[model samples]
Target: MMTTPIPKTMHAWRKHRGNMEAVWEEIPVPSAPPTGFLVKLIASGVCRSDHNLLTNEKQPSWFQQQFTLGHEGCGTIIEVGDCVPSNCGFKIGDVIALLSVPGCGQDDCPECSRDLPQLCQTGYHSGIGQDGFYAPYATIDVRGAVKVPQGVTPSQAAVATDAVTTAYHAIHRRGEIKENETVFLFGLGGLGFNALQLIRAIGARVIVSDIKQENMDEAKKLGVPEQDLVPVGRSVRKFVEEKGLVGKIDTVADFAGTQETFEDAQYIVRQAGKMLCVGTLNHKNTVHMKIGIRKRLSIIFSYGGQTQDLAKALELIQQGVLNPQVEDGKLYDFPAVLKALEAGNIKGRIALLQG
Candidate 1:
């Protein structure tokens, strides 16, 4: 039932061992897996993690030496695998958003059995350590693909796979932020901005801090009060103390992951407050033992989101509750986009549209 002819080879952005720069090279087109589909990518999102994959020397043992580098993608199914269930409702020409880390959902699998598939170590992590959707076409397992709804643009659907969904998972699930709680949020980058919107949707009072004044300004436009924004170059600890919020913040969502932010979070949150960490700007961070023990604070870390989280995130976007501030770029702009993201030049998320 194949109609349109797929090319035998296509160009992709990839990382090679020892090379800090991503290489644009041609590779053979992949065939659909028995339980997956062959998709022609319409849009893909550039993540800060993409930069880490290219430059970081130390990586997980599962990371491939060389692999295509894009995890967030939206595409159309060009071919369907024979093993894909008819009841799954996926079909050729269906547009779908992909989950980068769709874990092996075996009954005996530890993470999947616990409903934590995002942490599944047995499955291939696309774009993180495996060939992912930076090419014209990529194959995805049925467990990782969700059909994109009507009226959702490919760009919105693409970034929702990770950028929006990850924030949703962190704020709604891991942080367990309630409407009446006061949250001190650090960072306003791609994921941080989305977190702000989600926090607003929950009707929580959020105090935002970022190194960039533009981001803080953008937060104001998003309905965050002027007083809640920590001024650029102002010490977060001092700001909290001045505002009489020391030991008053109900939760600290540290999406900045800087040493300063970490230290500030420890000092500012109330006794027994929750610390939800999602960023990794500095992988290794120090915790004050006395401060932690005295306050009895709960430190929580979140990673990727589940398929259900992605679906809910998409629903929020469709309903206009979550407005992901994404800028559009072309697929070939991968290198420049990563450079800008690393330099903190890009505001909000950027989705690269496929030609």
Candidate 2:
């Protein structure tokens, strides 16, 4: 019953096969779907994953028409379809953050039944599988959205969709980190920093490894002891020993995903320890299979989190278990943002707040 004047076309940042992708340009607005609704973009996180997608030229084969590239977005509902189920809890004018993928709540579907539809390779995902936000208007699967509460900024809500959820899934869920256990975080970027917070909240210890002194300094400010921070040039094995963490590191949540970090993490994890690969790296890793097999290490490559995981991330934010930081200025200038990302000009997580 509620309505907002839907535009015929609006300025957006899109991804095509060629050079036209990153500029702020005009594109037709999408229509509401029978099982979904339309969202008016408010804020979206300019993630490193987007940079990875660009550099890797990772548009999937199923894509015919080009889709806009942002998946971590928050917006207000504009159009509602009658066929959308009441159980989905969507209504016009509600502020929400999108699920990165579609989890059709089909009872018989294996993934949907287990609340892990992100694993359903056949399913549709935002940005990767369909046109995502990064536009003035975009469609959202009704079951694939979570309400953003008033206390959270739209920018914070947007990053919570991916950065926060992914960190939570990799840290608390997959890592299975118990209190007092030590976690060595490789690369203190967006996802890495969030995992630091969650691990800290769990009363666990976190040792950080970063190439930048600024990143190491940031870790100190976040309560990681200066002694626990390891500069990247140093060997991962040597640092693990110097910190007295040799054979003691329970989990290594690898956000850097470089060959060096990947191989290093595998070497240092304790027996039965889990190493969660959360970052998207362009390089290939060469693991020492003999050492890996001997340690009985559990190496898991994880992608995005489930929709329920996003809901849990929101709850943690509401409870002050996490604090998301977004860089000031450079909000909504997509072309410039992409340039900064490519040049590595921006440090930490940055958000683009747009209409």
Candidate 3:
């Protein structure tokens, strides 16, 4: 393949409105921010959340129309702006994770000061309010860029920004699973799989359930005991009985956020046990308040991963504590990316490398 010169216009997948198909078009390359840089995207992961936005099912007013779509991008710095430090760490060739979350530029903004702009109401998210890296070139504010460890490929680090790190936050921060506690996971998709590994590393007894046996088998290979993986429709009582957790388990992490999974989470944990809702269940799903009140359980709704969590997840991958083995359909390039995402055949995170 021959490398082409940097052009004023490049190819990108774009959508004009919520609930519309994304079309590839020749769009102008974004410019570097005064305190930011323009990065040439190497690869960007297609998450299920992106699918939702693409479909416009949960489209917010800010992302009204015509925006580039992608957040989990990794690449090298190409053009740095005036405020960016020449020695602020990144160089022309350094591989870095795109923060994707834009701050309000207000020093007093609570979310910005805490380095967690993901929660800022005034802050804009890439692929949402601003143009994301669905193109070869994208603009990113410098505050959230993190250097990737040596030897990690762009595909491997693509999920570092969201899927993997989101699990890191849900497990380590929200669930707060102790070394001795038993942790049950509902759904074994991208987030649940990483949660499974993180729980295992914490020395917590981990049990996972999913509709797909493939994910279960994958979990088993990650050192989760065969007995720990369960089928989706099976009764929670069976899992509790088989694990001998009559009253031993302390937590259940529900990543599916379906009504059935939420109810199962309630039944699986012991009295006063905690259940963290880490999944993006945006649809009409409901849990009986009576059951929750009766169990006296702690239900925590966890959203995106914290900024610091990404670094920890990257470290775990580097140290061999976590492994993300993605398949071909889950890692397609730009030409095929939209088709795969539109068909909804993606098993996990779908990645698109810049052409």
Candidate 4:
């Protein structure tokens, strides 16, 4: 099969003025930034956050209008910029996943100096605070790209950068979910599903909860047992109590920060139990210090893909240890993808395919 030549203009999903669904447009193919590379995106994962953006809810004021809305993108380099090394371990056709962090703009901020660009005081973010990869090509800092391992597919690697890596960091680093411990996951969305796998991978017994029956069934199908999967509408604290696990759970990871979940997190965890909030839920989650103080509870908010965490997740994907259970994922070209995402019926992931 002959590969098509790069086009001068490419299809992109852009959110125009005001808050609205992303529309397909023949937009200029972005050029490589001064110190970055232009990647020909092979696949990009549609996240739940993308659903929110499409509805014009939870968009940061700084994002403005007319931007792409996917952070989980995997592709290969097609154009290189000036400052990046020509042989910086990335070749013209090497498949890679772009880490979600936006490149720092040569800022003299303290966080940037400390090698923490994600926390740069200037508040930059990819696919949200800036243009992202929902098209054929995306510009990224060469340093922000991690090459996908040989055994990982572009579709799997696309979600790996955020969903998988977020789970790995939350379970292993933040919550310290140890081997032989019990973990309670309070959500069955993409992030929660991956968290279940990661917790299982770490040799922990996991109990997953979701209000949607389909989500509950999917979690069980993804290796969580029927006995362990709890439907969301019921009282979680009562479930923990009836199961005789009031003080037995070592870690509770809440992807859904609902009022009930937070209350349940404190109630279900044992003394000194850790609670990991992997995704933003309900906008502002405020905890009463008095309630947590008595239990010695620890709370942490996990975000982004830490480099080392991403590497380990890639290793798991390569080894078939952790893989997303992508059911009903639609594979589309850029233009069709924009329409599907706007319609808002996609489940699992909507993977955009590039030549």
> How high is the lDDT of residue 65 in model 3?
64
Local distance difference test, each candidate: 0.91, 0.79, 0.75, 0.76
Tens digits of per-residue lDDT for model 2, 205-233: 88889888887888898888878888758
For model 3, how does the per-residue alpha-carbon lDDT over 131-225 read when each residue is reduced to its tens digit? 88788888777765778887666877877788888889889987888899888888787788888889989998888788777777788778887
What TM-score would you give candidate 2 relative to the actual structure? 0.90
Candidate 3 stretches with Cα past 4 Å from truth are 1-5, 113-116, 231-233, 280-291, 327-335, 341-344
Between candidates 2 and 4, name the one with more favorable TM-score: 2
Best by lDDT: 1
TM-score of each model, paired residue for residue = 0.94, 0.90, 0.89, 0.86
Q: Candidate 4, residues 1-355: lDDT per residue as tens digits?
A: 3556777898777766565657777878888876778898888887766656666555556765677767888888887788787668876777888876743635577766765555554544667757787878888786577889998988888888888888887778778888889989998777787788888888889998887888887777778887787755777887888888888998889988887788778878888888888766677766868768998988887766566677788889999888875432433354455456556455666666654
Instruction: Report residue 164 deviation for candidate 1 (angstroms).
Output: 1.1
* Structure candidate 4, residue pairs in collision: 210-232
Model 3 has a clash total of 2
What pairs collide in candidate 3? 19-55, 19-56
Judge candidate 1 at residue 175 and give its lDDT: 95
lDDT of 3 at 179: 96
Residues 24-115 of candidate 1: C-alpha lDDT, one tens digit per residue: 99999999999999999999999888988899969888888899999999999988898999888898899999999989998899999999
Error of 1 at 84 (Å): 1.3
